[model samples]
Target: MALPTLISAAQLHEILEQNDLVILDSRFYLTDLQKGRQQYELGHIPGALFVDLHHQLAGDETEQTGRHPLPEPSELADTLMNLGIDSQTQVVVYDDMGGAMAARAWWMLVQQGIEVFVLDGGFPTWQRAGYAIEAGCNQATVAEQRLTISYPWLVSEDDVVANLETERFQLLDARAADRFQGENETMDPVAGHIPGAVNRPFMQNLNEHGLMKAPSLLLEEWTSLLQDIEKPIVYYCGSGVTACHNVLAMNYAGLEAKHVYVGSWSQWAKRILRKIDEANA
Candidate 1:
């Protein structure tokens, strides 16, 4: 059977030579946004195009939207074409901070009904494994803008509010333990996590090197946190970025869930009427 939701370094090396494969470098830092591109210029997977995590993954900020909102589907479709991505292209996305940022790119592509895979360990793993790395910018022929509206699998704040008491789902918070516990709310004005939500930091899916652990290992870790798989799993993080990593990890474990809370903590905390940290506490 084929590897699930993951692409190996060797496999990636082979695909790098293929015309249908599109490699995207998604390395980014919230504090230092330009660092990702700088690293890409230093060295990257051959033919890999740099996808700015802040610009490409998120929508424009508005009074109603969160810090990293999902962009308009048509706009994103245009971005995919510019990046040389198509329905049949085998996309491989990776980043430095575990797979959080990279998974955001992965999820965005999937929202367009394009099945793209995450690099299991990201660029470092590929380099450590002695895989070939090319320096400077790499470019490919931008694919024709051939995008079709598929399913909108993203969940909004309204959906979360309505399903608060429903037994049909579980809201999984991928934020850090401190943020979840309300001890540390440095990022947002409102401290603590959503009501009735459980904390499951996205980094738990990977090791120190930012690579995903074995599928069996991830299965055990996630199953322990969530006792039942029948219940629908909805994930959220600071701004819907890292949460996608958890979703992608779960998909790798053969437990693909539905409707991730894309707005995540950023949007969730903006509500004053709704209970914030107390519900889940």
Candidate 2:
């Protein structure tokens, strides 16, 4: 059987010595692009490789692709191969910011049917538990591999536009209330969210300890939002990063939110501006 989607720090510590295990530290700060690598060099879980959200997980920023577009499939595949992560390697990803950043790696791997896990509560939880921590960069033995990849859970910007008219998917925004409400606008040019999308901040998935809420509680909360709505659910957030957190939470609670708008609001807002400019021209 495949490993569960989430693993506690203690559970991960037990499997630390497994030959097939590959731990990835995806810690990132949206404001400071290089901070993730700096933190990784300072300290990280033993045998872990650092993956920068900007360079590794995301592709070049373009007018059409948004701030943090999904990396080309081959790009990530090559990175994994260089990390010696072949088909048999089991992956575990964690971040300092709860599971917000780590969930990005987890989502990408899971979509390819790879048996990967997000460290419950992430790196902070592991540190709190007094686990072994290593400093400096850890290198992997590179191996030759060509992985077959697919994004079954991804939805394109065009699909989101179409949903505005059809309502086939119940769109949810994973950004905070302030951002969703068009206040304190900073990241993107325009404010607010795509039409028909409701706010469901990703932080709601965590508790006072910054750990995930119990499965029952998660299910109960999701049930209230989904009551009698049969439409398939989709999630999006600024730059398509934190959105994965909500997706992970829903999946952990035994609910399916298989569709993610990878371009998310950053792309949507930019495209809206281009359209307005064209009309004014």
Per-candidate clashes come to: 2, 0
* lDDT on C-alpha atoms for all candidate structures: 0.80, 0.88
Q: Any idea how many clashes model 1 has?
A: 2
**Index of the highest-TM-score prediction:** 2
lDDT of 1 at 212: 83
The C-alpha TM-scores of every prediction are 0.91, 0.97
- Which sections of candidate 2 miss by over 4 Å? 1-3
lDDT of 1 by residue, 132-191 (tens): 888899776888756864437788878888987675678899888999998768877788
Error of 1 at 180 (Å): 0.6
Residues 125-239, model 2: lDDT tens digits: 9999999899999988785666876787889999998888889998889999999999998888999989888888999999988888998999999999878778888889998
Segments in model 1 whose C-alpha atoms lie over 4 Å from true places: 1-4, 165-167, 228-230, 273-281
Model 2, TM vs. native: 0.97
Q: Which ten residues in a row have the lowest lDDT in candidate 1?
A: 272-281
TM match of model 1 to true structure: 0.91
